[model samples]
Target: MKSSGKRGTRSFGAVELLPTWHWSQFTFFTMVDHNGNESSAPYFILIGLPGLERAQFWLAFPLCSLYLIAVLGNLTIIYIVRTEHSLHEPMYIFLCMLSGLDVLISTSSMPKMMAIFWFNSTTIQFDACLLQMFAIHSLSGMESTVLLAMAFDRYVAICHPLRHATVLTLPRVAKIGMAAVVRGAALMAPLPVFIKRLPFCGSNILSHSYCLHQDVMKLACADIHVNIIYGLIVIVSAIGLDSLLISLSYLLILKTVLGLTREAQTKAFGTCVSHVCAVFIFYVPFIGLSMVHRFGTQHDSLLPVIMANIYLLVPPVLNPIVYGVKTKEIRQRILRLFHVTTQTSDP
Candidate 1:
């Protein structure tokens, strides 16, 4: 099989492949492979919460509320970071990036998920599914990188307080952001390529409301050794490496803090509390979801789904709250914004 050279191109042998859409449930999409050979089962049916089929209406309430909060909260963070010139430091800039990522990530999957819940619109086209999978995973990798960047900012602020400004300049931070995007895209670009080249001969039903690389991979009848190995490498090199470096940065910060005066240490450590909380919220559910996928039995199949919801939705929802509550500058800006809105709205 030839690897993908473009966004939607797939290789079969030596012939050209193209994707076409049909109207049936079984053959919703037909992909013509290298020799112009066509195969059905190019569509994926999202089997979202089979156990809660009857309760989708009620489930919609909380899920919709969370989506609303995630959007508004992250947008507020972006606004504050943009308007408040004092908040344009490296740490807040990274926070803004994280919040913006939260918005993107939340918006990417929630619309389809809400549709799946409200309208039972579970049929996702093959090409669309691949795009969703790439967006979700790439955004996740970028968020992890942003978190790692924030950890570094905290370390510098604590360890080298005088040079923090010089170390994390705006241009450097912009480069860091670009690097994060490139790293995530480069790492996950091959996932859809590999999956598309393999002939999917089995069930096309997906286990969750959204497309995940691993979940979709399980539906392939072909040997997925390359897919699996590449996924593991992506995870280790991106998220795992990020977590490790973030931890190391904090450890070094801790060591440096030991030499500071008591008051100085308290002042320095306070700035890191929000980031630590955000990290915990993100990693705990992510790790749990991974564990469920790898080791949990069919009896606990929904464990991964629930963990994924928590992993993706909770961080975005809570990160803004954590930062708003912990950082006095951010908290004040939020309050002022609300106060202005309230005063303007009075009838």
Candidate 2:
């Protein structure tokens, strides 16, 4: 816990925007000082949507539906891939990891948000908040790494078909995934420690329905220069660098694809459509979130809140759908699964 009764006054950086913890509206504001405890852990209140408070109860329906769909869809992908021997290949293995990460990303924040929306349980303990923050950011980083690994898988499969088997062995992919988990965990492990050291003397009222490191750190009365710098470093080194490498991997993939015959080109590119869709949905909101944080010094807008919600929700919901629809193998298997279920139920 890092909050308590009262408020203090302080200003650390430029104005920042606050997004809803779930898919809802929120107002952005600058952090100012208030009088409160220097070291005591303080609880926080979650605001689901700023202007649309009355509708939050109803909004819970859709948000909960989306969460269920996200979880079930991703979990289905994992199950299908695990059970289907044909899908034990490197590509689907990576897809399984992606789905797992998606489940984690959605689960990290959605449950508490549901509580706020449906039950009006807006209060979160400080330690729980820290745990949620770590889960969200670290899982997000792992997803980015998985996406990058997928891009590499596609590159090797298409560009160097002969080496595809050798390059992306099951063991190698497992190693890469383990490395991603390790890297993300190791990098973000310091975040909770950093925030915990600061004294939150400002208003314990958080801008979003969930705890974010940036939002949480903003309430501190003490200097958070280390937090700020280290946060930036983590973003750039992990997600930003992964984005760059994924792009490079695609560039090489495109180069290799272009050398193929017309028919070969179409077939080759089709394999990437699902991945491309996933990449866009995952990164677009991420870019939006980053830009809003970077440039949100002068005004308040819905973009920050909107982007934050989308960043967490869209990828998880869409990845499985895209893969299920675009990839023939997955699509056929899913259909067969449903058909079997229908047949069994009818009897």
Candidate 3:
């Protein structure tokens, strides 16, 4: 029997004939050689799995639409905060930071996802993939940190109204926001560095819509036990523990509110209710993703795609609407800004 072997693109033929039984053994042994010696090559793979063509189409269309709305909505918030001097308070400044972060978080992954859906191009450069992973996580971590700061802002304002001005001054708020951004970037940047160093000897296809750390690390050739542990620690600290502290801050605020007059209590709770809702919507999906990834079936990929988009996009789109409508000052300011623009544009 003639034996054939493939090394990269070049094929080698047997110089001497072997018995059929020996050829079978040779094929098995040579397969290990192919696995060990194969060089990496880029290939286009569908973002979603096979048999999910319709699912991909349906998911991509709404995701693209949501991403656009998120971008425009967050931009409007930033513009409003920057151009309107009367809105220059600690609350609105934090809101501006949140809007900026939302824009970064949503745009980070959505554009690439839309590209994959529209063009059927899922081949990401190794460096680009690493950058994308780092950016998404960094922005997400920043958002969480910003939210915690916002909670503290609210806590001080409601619980200690007289000291609010001195406590959250412009310089102080700016410093806090900058620190949050720096902290987030510093914490998340190392993850991608570690991930990129691992050898990817298997299929390069990413199972999820975006370059998630968990999904990308699954392609590693060597052991990932330590990486997974480190990831869990990061997630627990950045997201899980942050959420807990925010919750505790709110709980203290609730106790303080309860001791006040009915009218004051009502006003305070109303101010925070929108933020509470926004936080819940933002974090529930994240917690779900973590739980599912750790304890549930990893092969079920749709859960994560849906959860990721919801966590990233929904809050950005809804935040402006929720806070703008709920707060009388912000609502009137938005209307006044629009009215002035309309008058200025009249011919």
Candidate 4:
């Protein structure tokens, strides 16, 4: 509902509401400066893929395909895991949560990205921008927590095979999932609020196709020491801690794997191949983006933008593919599902 009626400004109507709230729809306003000057209150011009404006249509095609494949593939994983009685295990359940997170996070950015590349529509309402930032960052933190939970599940399953069922029972896994969500939401709650409260008197042009915390933080006109410190603490306490614990859990898992017979070791370690790939896909780009943001400030702007996009888009696209092709159960179930559909449709 926050928008300016200036000549170049754009207003998104009811279609922009995340969940279609009537009261929050069809309203508009302009920003009032301290000296009684009025300007656009809640608008940002997203400079998507700078210097590549001519290739926007070409860029949209591949990105659109990635978005579709990510959604369909992850949804398929969820459906198979839920419907198949044989897959009602802790690992598949965690995978289902992972898929759901992928869909949620990607949805927050992909729509706006398509709008930018396809329609050349780059104006984003301020509130919607904050919402997108919240969803992307919180869901990213949730992904790390979910991965840590899965690491613990594997640690139990391999190291304490006898106690695996009792330790990671359905209720316990559910509790872990709830804890992950709560922890993420609690830690990331201040991110959007911090960015929102900051005065955006300067250029509101986002560096990428979608809203990201770092991208938005740099645009604030006010002193941002508090926001910077709190954001760092949230990242360290949540994602950093989860990454460290996940590493430790895998170390213990490796120790347990080493104690088994050679054949048993191969079989046991195969279970983690998919997870390791997914971890790398998610973390490598994230870590790279962080490093570049800190150390490569003098480098080309396109590099950071590319890294940030990869940090966001790669995991969702790769998680389902890795799980589907690497995990035997999912692959066989997908084949069987298609086979049944083919037979049913034969006339």
Candidate 5:
């Protein structure tokens, strides 16, 4: 096999293979040998940001601060929901579940990103990279399902007020949560496995500070049509379908609210404002990132990386704050919790 030695170009018998995409401009390839054996990197590098490489060290502080806030805020939500018997309703139950998923989603991607930015420890083992990818996408899907369940809870509370208790009993809510877990896990399980089977004979430096299935798949030298198709299927089945259902539920809710008295309408819509904010926070960045990855390759590469990181971090950091501020029960409980703590610690 002859070698061109430009961007690690190598001859695979009769075919001369150039690296894939513009990202190959950033790094060299270490591809398969003449025997078609896997010579891919056992570890991958996470370059934080493409255009702003010089500022990445300083960027770590804000990212780390956001991660800390996400963890603390979500934990407080969980603590309040668990301790306050009044919040044992289906709505708060789903909120608690969402908080848990938020924590998982941010934690899965942030620590490694912090390492890359703070210490430049960017090398991640192939297996560990795959694990992070699974955790992030799976938890994100589960969060979508949980949000859907919360929308349903709101629908029942506002539209079918008398039937709310009977319709969404604790057992049913628990079953819904379990289904979210199973569906998210089962659908995303093949993603990492598919990447594992593909021969990654190119630059293993990922586009973002994290390992996404889409980002990792692009590095593979083999035909990736299957990966692309399966990725779309997962998105459609999980986020896309869930989003449509949640929207439909809200439409029905709107109709119900329109028929109510003005005071009642205000009260009903107020209840959903936090959830609406949460939904937008999760989906906007997610869809933007997806579009940038699929369609905006010609645009600045930094757009996708920024959108991906926002998709991962924004919902977690903002959801808790939205709920704490918008939901009356949660806000009061948080205040009470602080009041008690302050009194207990007084000198």
Candidate 6:
């Protein structure tokens, strides 16, 4: 009988030949299979600027504390203005709106950022990330618009004192506040929609502790040329245009005030100084951040942190302080409500 085991044959005969395989080809196939397996698994790596642990800790702790103070301070202002009948005017109404915006603004990013630092947790859900981005930018945009409106209100009140009551009536102030909200929402809503639609197939790690527009956009896989162009247009129109208008309004106010008597001008300037300071503290860093993010180098991570603190946290903390110290009536009212004695008696 023929051999019961398999055998290799060189010529055709009654026996079958076994298939032959080259060892080199088998090794090459194995190597390719191993590489394909390695490539198929996704890798997770922490990617962002380092050396910020100490700075982040210091910054985040104080910022979180200040955020609490900001919320309480602004809320107190809103309550005082709303409840006190004597404070019912266009200026105070605008102040109340500003205080409300401050609360929203601080609450938007500071708390989450603090948690990230304290917990060493940097991962954020895609939707939550987008929401945070929208909230912060939207509130910021609203704040700028509101500042412009407030400047106009002051302009009308001081320059056109005769028509202040008619021009800045309750209905009119409400209408202006509504318009500011709508305008801000309209301007900022598009940013998130554009960002969300972009394909992010590569790195998911955000450079900053929070979800800023440019930071998130950097991770996009698809082309962002159009998005960048639209972003520039929006920033210029919304922030730049608003800043220019505010500056012009203040210039006119300054001209009008300068023409008044020394005492009158000082008093008028005092009335607006708080708002002006608040606006400056709020906008300078804001515009600076936009510029730096757009034009600055990738190594400039400190810019975002510093800018975030200045524009996001500082204004909210300082606004109440500025207005409280500048405005005597509100200060006294707050003292009276809190039962703090301001008067001294002599025997």
Best by TM-score: 5
Residue 106 in model 5: lDDT: 92
List residue ranges in candidate 1 displaced over 4 A: 1-40
Candidate 4 lDDT over 37-81, as tens digits, reads 434347766766766778977988998898899999999999999
What are the clash counts of all predictions, listed in order?
Answer: 1, 14, 0, 1, 0, 0
lDDT of candidate 5 over 224-268, digit per residue (tens): 999999999999999999999999999999999999999999999
Candidate 2: segments with Cα more than 4 A from true spot: 1-37, 297-302
Q: RMSD in angstroms, all models?
A: 6.8, 6.6, 6.5, 6.7, 4.4, 12.6
lDDT of every model, 2 decimals: 0.84, 0.82, 0.75, 0.82, 0.88, 0.74
TM-score of 5: 0.90
**Residue 46: error of model 2 in Å?**
1.6
lDDT of candidate 3 over 207-239, digit per residue (tens): 566787887877677788877988988888888
Candidate 2 on 1-347: residue-level lDDT in tens? 23322253224332222222322332223232343123433466676766677998998899889889999999999999999999999999999999999999898899888998888888888889999999988888888889999999999899889999988998999999999899889888899999888776445666666777887887787888999999999989998899999999999999988889999999999999999899899988888877777678632354565677788889999999999999999999999999999999995
What's the true lDDT of residue 12 in model 6?
A: 25
For candidate 5, the lDDT comes to 0.88
Please report how far candidate 4 places residue 130 from its true position, in Å. Answer: 0.8
lDDT of 6 by residue, 195-262 (tens): 86776544455556677777777767678887788778878988888889989988999999999999
Clashing residue pairs in candidate 1, if any? 15-34
Best by lDDT: 5
* Candidate 2 to truth, TM: 0.88
Better of 5 and 6 by TM-score: 5
